[model samples]
Each structure stands twice: as C-alpha cells, then as structure tokens.
Target: MKRKLLVTAFLLGALLLAAYPMFSVAASSGDVGGLIAESDINPRAARTVESYSLESSHPYSNNFDYTWTITEPGATQIRVHFTKIDVENNYDYVYVYDYAGSQLHKLTGLYSSGGWTAWSYGESIKVRLDTDYSVTDWGFAIDQIEYEGGGGGGGSETNVLTDGVTSSSSLAATGDTEMWTIEVEADALSMHSVLTCGSADFDLYGRLGAEPTTSTYDWRGYTSGGEDVTFDNPGAGTWYI
Candidate 1:
C-alpha cells in the first residue's frame, strides 16, 4: 500500500531557500510564504550576472573619506556585493548605510571574495570608505547592486520543479515561514530536501497532510546549510514543506 504525507518548511529567522526537490507537488501561489509582487512586499533580489562597479580611492590612499550613494527611485531595498576587500584590518573601515542614514555594517580586513551586505530598506544606500593616515591595503569594490524592481520587468516568479532542481527565495524578519507541497510516487524510493542559508541561520520542518509547525513537524532540519531531511521507501502522497 502507498502511504500519503505532507511536508512543510518553517524559518525561524531571515534566510535563503535554495533547493527543495523530490517526486512531489509544486508550490502554489496561495501556499504560505509564496511569492508576492515586488511592490507589495520588499523581497531580496537574487544575485544576477548584471553588475556595477565602484572602487575605492586608487593606490589606497590615507586619510581618505568619501561616500557614494546609489539610488533607484521607488526601490524598496538595496544591497551591495563586494568583489574584493583588502584593507588594514580594524585600522581602515568600510561603512554601509541605509537611505535614512542609519549604519548597517562596518567591514574591515580581508574577506573572501563575493561577500555582500544585507538588504538595506528604501531607495538609496550609501557606501563610505574611511582610512587612517597610517596604513592601507588593496581596498574594496562594489561590483554589484541588487534590488527588486518596483514594477514592470520585475515581479513574482515561480519555479515548477520536476526532479533534482533548485529554487531560490529570501525571507524577511524573524519567525518567517515559507512552504511548498510535494507528491511522492508509488515507485519512489526516497524523499529529500535541503536548505542553504547564506550568512544567516534558519530552520526547516516537514509534515504529512496539514502544514507543519515548529513543534509539530514530523521531520526537522536544525543545522546551518547542513540541514537535510530524507525519507526512505517513502509514502505516495502530498507533502507540505
């Protein structure tokens, strides 16, 4: 006899959803944590090939203080992707500020390439470089500015998965939960799901039939980026996750 089950994914905090695949049901627009118009909700933009460049003072001079503002009118959130960061650790600093002039991050020293700042709310974001007279290194560059389109050309996009495919999405605030449904086949041998949280930590939960809660979930993944849930000789029904 083929058993039926539902799986659900719950996030305790903000994070990215990378891959959720199996012989399962596709997530509908009405599903909890589903897509929304960029105008309605300020969701984070997925990293893309398109990029812009802003480099620090050439030769990495000393006593340099400069601020650059990047704006897209009506934009809800803004982010900067750092391609390179090499400055005197702690001595020299790069500051990130939001449109309201509130500080978001202070970075220094060397960081692995492709580091990015958290999404800053509003239409503008400021990046400033402050250096001491004593020492300096290669400095940093903002190679990419990511944000969701207020309208036209950027809207909610959904991914329908068949097998072994990944979909990317981001959640905002604490206790945010995004869910999807999956259907297992009678011949299916196993069901697996993976969640990859970048820079932030999140939790995943799964259950059969109805939505799963933090405590009521049948399957839970508690590791960072290492969260995985698999069922062998699985049931043949819809899973909510």
Candidate 2:
C-alpha cells in the first residue's frame, strides 16, 4: 500500500510538471509583446509625383511645430507615411512625444526634390528633421500613422510636429478631417484629444469597415493648448485603428 501511494504521488508530480509548460505557453501566446503590424498605405512609385501642395503661408510657418496625442496608451510600435514635397533644401521628418510632451523618437532623413517617402515603424523617440543649408520647402503629405505594442501589453503613443510643417492654411493646419484614419484590432479600445492652436489641430477618427467597443477619452494639456487623449482595450487584436 505504501509503495502504491508513493507511485501515485510521483505520477501526480510528473503530470503537474508537464501541465505547467502548456499553461505557460498559453500565457505567452496571449502576450506576443507589442508589435506594429503591416500598413495599408503604399508609397508612391515616383518621388517626383506631387499629389498635393500646401497653401501659401501654410504648414503654419516656415518653421512648424505640431503635436498628436496618442489615444491608445502603451503602444510599443508605430508606422508613419507621408507624401514628399518638391522644393530646394526641403527637409521633412516626424517626432514621437510622451504624455508629458517629452521627446521620444526623432525620425528624419527624408529629402524631396519631388516624390513620396514612407517611414517604417520602430521603437524610438524624438524629432526627425532634414539636414541641409538652404531652407527649401519642408513638409510631407502625411498619409497614415500607426502604433504597436508597449509596456504591460498597452503603451502610450503621441507625436509632435515642429520646425517643419508650420502654416495654418496647410492641409494639416486646417484640422482637415479627411487626412487619415485610426484602427484598433484589440477587443476594447479608447481615445482622447486636445487641440492647442485653434487653427492647427490633430483631428482623429475611426474607419467605416469595423470598429472596437470602448470609451473615448479627451483631456487638455498643461501647456501648448492641446488636449491629451487616452484609449484602452480589453484584449488584443490583429490590428488597431
């Protein structure tokens, strides 16, 4: 009887050990880390193709500074694309900002004699600018912006437009609602926003095909007159807008 009981106990211990990995895998599978998936927008074939042009005295000024609040917090990855403008000494770039308006990612190096260029998604924070002596037109026809994973399966994402696109009459300056779209593949999602300059603002909206069920948030920033937005989801998804 003693030997039988000992054997039963040993068998139970082995079974638990075997079950642990499966449980761990299930947990790990649920946690794929934060990744910004593929993008729908494709770069223009010709860099010389000028699809759109900024209005005179647009981009707000020769020097532009703008900010985009990340409605979804804890985003680890991001993808941004833009249409390159044609001009002499023209430089364009994007910057990633934290909740406190702190610099995070600076993505630069896109110069346009003419054409469209896109920036790939990665983990970085700060402002990206053009490196040239003569000040040519510096701005891109921004097509789309995407965010991926971050801390605790959720991350904060935000962007600041500065020293580049500065005119109030520009497409991005008019608070153009038709510029871009946001998508989220997670189970639940949330968002918030704040506009500093009345003339220039970051207008965010969802697509028509599919949408997530969650609360949208909006808050005003301490400075710069912009709002801080935050969005949260219950679980994960293949994509989030």
Candidate 3:
C-alpha cells in the first residue's frame, strides 16, 4: 500500500510541474499592466537624433492616453511619419502638438496609413493617443527627424546662433537678408546647416567668413521649402547661414 501511494504522489508532482508554465502564460495574457500608465523617452543629447518609434505595451487597455513629448536642442522643425497606425478607427485617435502647445494634427486609420508623414513647425511636438473604454488595437508608431534652422529661407542680416542651441524667430521678408552666425570652437569632420520656410517665400543662402555680408558669400543655396549646406573639410571658423 505504501509503495503504491509514493508512486501516485510522484506522478501528480510531475504533471503539475509540466503544466505550471502554460498556466502562468495564460494568466499574464489577460492581465495588462494597469488602467493608467505613461511612457517618456529622452534621447541622447548633443548628437543628432533622427528617428523614433513609439507603441503601447502588449494588450493595450482602453480609456487611456499615451502621451509623448519630445524636446531637442538645435532643432528647428520635426518631421513625423506614421509607420503603423492601427487604432479604433473613428473614436480612438492620435493628436500632435507643436512646441507652442498648439494642436497641429489629428491622425487615424480612417485618413492615414503607414506612409503618411507630417511636419511640425516648431522645435518640439507632443503626440497622444486617447481611447475610449471599448475596443483596442495594436496602437501606432511615428518616426521623426529634427531640422536645425527652422526651415524658413535664409535672409541677409546675420543673427548669431548660440553654440548647440536652436533659436526660433520670424522673417519679415522685406527683400533685405536674414543671416545666422556660428563660430566653430573645435574641429569638425563635417559642417552643415538647414533652413526651413514657414509662410512667406524666401531664398536660402549660406557662406563661411570671419564676417559675412550680402556680397561676400562662399556658398549659396536655392531651395524654396528647405535646404542643407554641408562642407567636408570645414576648418574651425565662423559659418554664416
């Protein structure tokens, strides 16, 4: 009788050990983290950061808002591309705001897809997805790039830019020129500047000089929307854009 009882106990223990992993998975699958949770991402600084992807955790819940705020120095504008936007169609949507905290756009699957891209006119953008307490999907992803010179066409009168910082200003477009100056304190493998336009049409231009004027230009760029000027062996000096 005792031998039979020991054999039965050993069989029961083996069966439970084999089934524990399966049971644990089943339990976790139904229990999402919480009703309210937020994720914040701060990228590496000084170096240029070009792209980002964001999503809710597995088994996302309803009645929640996942907000993302990105702040970058030396950033003039941020371009966003929606790669995977699968929300609850009509109700659940993603909202985009500019650095001034103004609503730039509202996106959803009804009008957007994986290839749709948007541009923020300011240095930072806040993205949020709000869902009702109903159905849920896998959420969305946005890839972003920050351009330094605020996109407006460069004008003539040079404005000095602080080292490794972005300055936001306006262009009057009086046919004069708006310029920015940067003094390189160290050697750089490459030097580049970007200009993005807002409303008025202006032409972009850049040059290297100890001092820049309308007549003394080493290089010029002619792009309506935006332009980039790069130098390969840009010896440390003053760069005007």
Candidate 4:
C-alpha cells in the first residue's frame, strides 16, 4: 500500500502555490523534486479540522503589553486566522509579528471578524496585545494558526504555485486531502493538473473561490487510476485544489 500522492500542475505562465496537509507518516518513496524539503513543510493533516488556536486574555486587560509566539521547529510559513475581535477601536490593538519580531498585521476594533494575518515566514510568529489604561473589550480569538514546517523560509510575496512543478505528499491515513492554491491571471492559455496516486485510491476536487469537497466542486478527477484535469480560458483569481 503506497501512501504517496504526487500532483503535478502545468500553468502556461500562471503562478502556483501548493498547500498540502500535514501528516506524521514517514516520507513517501515517490519522487518529489519540486516540493520543499520534508523537514520544512508539513501539510495539514486533514481538511476537516483546523490546526491550533490563539486567544487574547478573556476581556483582555488594560495597560497590557505582552506577546505570545507560536513556533514549529522547521515551519516555512505561518498564517493566523481570527474568528472574533472586540477591542477598543483605537486605544487597544492586537499585533501579529513574524519570527524576527517584525510587525505583520494589526487587529483593532469590533469589525475585525474573519481577518487573516499575512503569511509569515520562518517557524515562529508573535502575537502581541497592547492596551492603554482606558478601556478594554472582549479582545480577539484566532481560530486557527496554520504553519508549513521545514525549509528556508521567506522569499515569494505570495504562495504562488510555480508553473510546471511537481509536488508530492504521503497521506498517513484514509480521508486525508491536501489543499493547494493557484493564482490564474486573465487570458491565460490553460491550467492543467496531473494527480498520480499509487495503488491507494484518491479523489481530486477543485473550486474557484473556496476549498472544494467531494460533494461540491467545480472540477473533479474521480477515476480510480491517476487523474488529469484542465481548465481553458479559466476565470481570473484564486483557484483552490
């Protein structure tokens, strides 16, 4: 039972960003020349669950200035998603920092729901809360913190999936799906994806604006053998796979 799934995408000139799920499984024997080293990149374990969470002190605290850093040994990238935010409009703030302590994002006021920090490079990121002695509110809660372990972090401004790149991953168990993204520009020739799964069966799904699932998807490669999918004159924007 081979545990590896190799996916190769060819975009005439579009940029590709491959985001895989993490698994504790051993490295696959299959070739993955295009993927970052195993030590630096850990894809999500499963699409169904978000990884970790970070929350400000309940109701936060006045005159508070503290930082929390999340680190994964070899993570190449770290992303934070805020599910809720309720801090003083301008008197208080929640700041996000990269491994080197440089400011990355700031969350303030009540309308900060569903905000995501720009992707941070390196294995660690710092979240700091600075409050004045005036007022404080419910603060914020980060529902998920995603990190891709291992590699020489930083470089590309965006996680573009390079053209004609081959990336591979080993799914440790059943029902594991790796997620990836590609930014397709207008009037491009075409975008193609080739999925090669060893003996194990896997399904490929794609959507334009959001993550795809077995039930809802814009394109699917359902055959038992390796699958191929392509889009011609595809719309401009992000395409999830």
2 against 4, candidate with superior lDDT: 4
What lDDT would each prediction earn against the true structure?
Answer: 0.56, 0.29, 0.47, 0.61
Q: Write the per-residue lDDT of candidate 2 for residues 15-98, one digit (tens) a residue.
A: 111100000000011111122223443353211111222211212233433333323234444434333322233254454454
Cα deviation of 161 in candidate 3 (Å)?
A: 30
Following a full C-alpha superposition, what root-mean-square deviation does model 3 have from the true structure? 24.8
Q: In terms of lDDT, which candidate is stronger, 1 or 3?
A: 1
The TM-score values for the models, in the order shown, are 0.43, 0.27, 0.39, 0.42
* Residue-by-residue lDDT tens digits, candidate 1, 1-241: 2212222332211222223232211112221111111222233543222355556543466876656566543567767666666679889988888878899878777653535676778755777778899976777665666665542224322122223445456766565566555444455666677766656667767666445777897687877653667755556544555
Tens digits of per-residue lDDT, candidate 4, 54-96, equal 5555666688775655544466777665665667987898788
- Could you tell me the TM-score of candidate 2? 0.27
Candidate 1 runs further than 4 Å off: 1-49, 151-241
RMSD of 1: 19.6
By TM-score: ranked, best first:
1, 4, 3, 2
Write the number of the candidate with greater TM-score, choosing between 2 and 4: 4
- Candidate 3 lDDT, 140-223, residue by residue in tens: 555534344443223233343433334345554355555565444334555555555544445454555433445666665566
Count clashing pairs, candidate 1: 16
